[model samples]
Target: MIAYSVTVPKEYGYVILAATSTFFLNFWHGTRVGLFRRAAEIPYPHPYATAEQISSASPDKKQAMYLFNCAQRAHGNYLENHPSMVIAMLVSGLQYPRTAAVLGAAWAVFRIIYAVGYTRADKQEGKGRLAGSGFWLAQLAAFGLAGWVGVQMIMGQA
Candidate 1:
C-alpha cells in the first residue's frame, strides 16, 4: 500500500468550490435543454437548427414552443457566458480568490433564477434577467480587481 498527501493553497479553496458549482450549474442547464428537446421530439441537429425552423416545427402549440425556446435559451446563454466566467474565475482566483468565489457562486444562482423566470414567462426582461445581468457585472468587477491586484503585485505594491 502507498499513501500520498496533497495540499492546496487556502486562497484556492473557495475558488475551487465556486468553479465546481458553476460547472454543475452549466451542466444542469444543458441537461434540462436536452430533456426539453427530447420531449419535443426535436432531433439533435435540429435542436441546433435555426430559430425559424424550431418554431415552425412546433407551430400551433404555444406552450410547446415556449418550452423549446426556454431550453434553447438556457443552453445558449450558458455557452455564451461560461467561457468568460471560467477565464475571470481563473484569473481572479490567483489573486482575489474569495471575491472570485462569491461572484462565481452568485453568477450560478442568478443564472438559475434567470432560467426559471424565462421558462415560466417565455420572455426576457424581468427580475431574473436583471439579476443575471447584475451577476455578470459582478464577475467583470472581480476580473478587473484581479487584474489590478496582479499589476500591483508585479509593481511590488500588493
Candidate 2:
C-alpha cells in the first residue's frame, strides 16, 4: 500500500470558509423551509405536496402548499447536487485553493438565487430557470477543476 499526503495551501482558509458557508446556508434554508411547511400546513412523512393534495385544497391552501413545495424543492435541489459539488471543491482545492474558493462562493450564490426564484414563482413552469441560470455553470467549473487536478496529480505535475 502507498500513502499519499497533500499540503494545505495558505489560501485554504478561503476555501474552508466557502465550503463551510455552503453548509451554513443550506442548513439555514432548511430551517426556513420548516417554518414554511408549518405555515402551509404540510404534515410530516410526505416529502412533497402531491397533485391530489394541491387539488383538494382551498384556494388559499393551494397557494400556500404550492409555495411551500417550491421552497422544499429548492432545498431539495441543493441537497441533490451537494455531495459532488462540495467534494469537487475540496479535491480541486488541494492544488488551486483560491480558484476553488471562488467557484464555491459562486455556487453558494447561485443556489441562493435558485432557491429564492423557485420559492417566489407562481407556478412550476420552467422550474426557475432564470434564477438558476448560473448554477450549472459554476457546478461544472468545480467538477472540471477537480478532474483536471486529478489528472495532473496522476501525471506527477501537480
Candidate 3:
C-alpha cells in the first residue's frame, strides 16, 4: 500500500480553531433551518417548496414558507462560500496565522448577522442584509490578502 503524509505548520492551530468554529456556526444555522421546515410540514426531501404552492396555501402555511425560504437562503449562502473560505484560511495560516484567524472569526460573525437580518426582514433588502453584505466584502478582502501573502511566501518574496 502507498501512504501519503501532509505537514501543517504549528501556527495553523489558531486557523484550525477559527475555521472549525465557523463551520459549526454554519452547521447550526442549517440545522435550525431544517427544524423550521419540519415544523412547517414542508416535507423532508425538499425544504423549498414551489412559489405557486406557497401562494395558494393557507395563511399559516404561507408564513411558514416565507420563514423557511429566509432560513434556507442563509444556509445556502453559507454553504456556497464555506469551502473557498476554508481553503484560503488553511493556506494563508501557514504564512499569516494572525490574519487568517481574524478573517475566519470575522466571517463567522458576519454570517450570523446575515442570517438574523434575512430571517427578521419582511422584505429581502434591509439594514441587517446590507450590514451583512458589507461584512462579507470585508471577509472576502481578508481572504484575498491572505492568499496574496501565501503566494508571496511560496515564491520566497515575503
Query: Top TM-score: which candidate number?
Result: 2
Residue 85 in model 3: lDDT:
84
Model 2: how far residue 57 lies from native, Å: 1.4
lDDT of 2 by residue, 1-158 (tens): 43458899999888888899998988978997987798789899777788999899998888888888888878888899989999998999989999999999999998888887877746465366467669799899999999999898877788
lDDT of 3 by residue, 1-158 (tens): 43424356677899999989986897799788987787567876885867887889898787777778888878888888888888888777776778788888888888888888877746543345555775577567667877697577657666
Q: All candidates' TM-scores?
A: 0.77, 0.91, 0.83
Task: Point to the candidate with the largest lDDT.
Answer: 2
Candidate 1 collision pairs:
none
- The order of the candidates by lDDT, greatest first, is 2, 3, 1
Report RMSD for candidate 1. 6.3
lDDT of 1: 0.70
Q: What is the lDDT of candidate 3?
A: 0.77
lDDT of 3 at 53: 70
lDDT of 3 at 93: 79
Q: How big is the positional error of residue 12 in model 3, measured in Å on the Cα after superposition?
A: 2.5
Alpha-carbon deviation at 110 in model 2, angstroms: 0.5
Q: Which candidate, 1 or 2, would have the higher TM-score against the true structure?
A: 2
Each model's lDDT comes to 0.70, 0.85, 0.77
lDDT of 1 by residue, 1-158 (tens): 33433334488888888888888888888788877676666676765445665557645354555576666876687788888887788777766778888888887887787776666553543334544566667667867877886686667655
Error of 2 at 10 (Å): 0.5
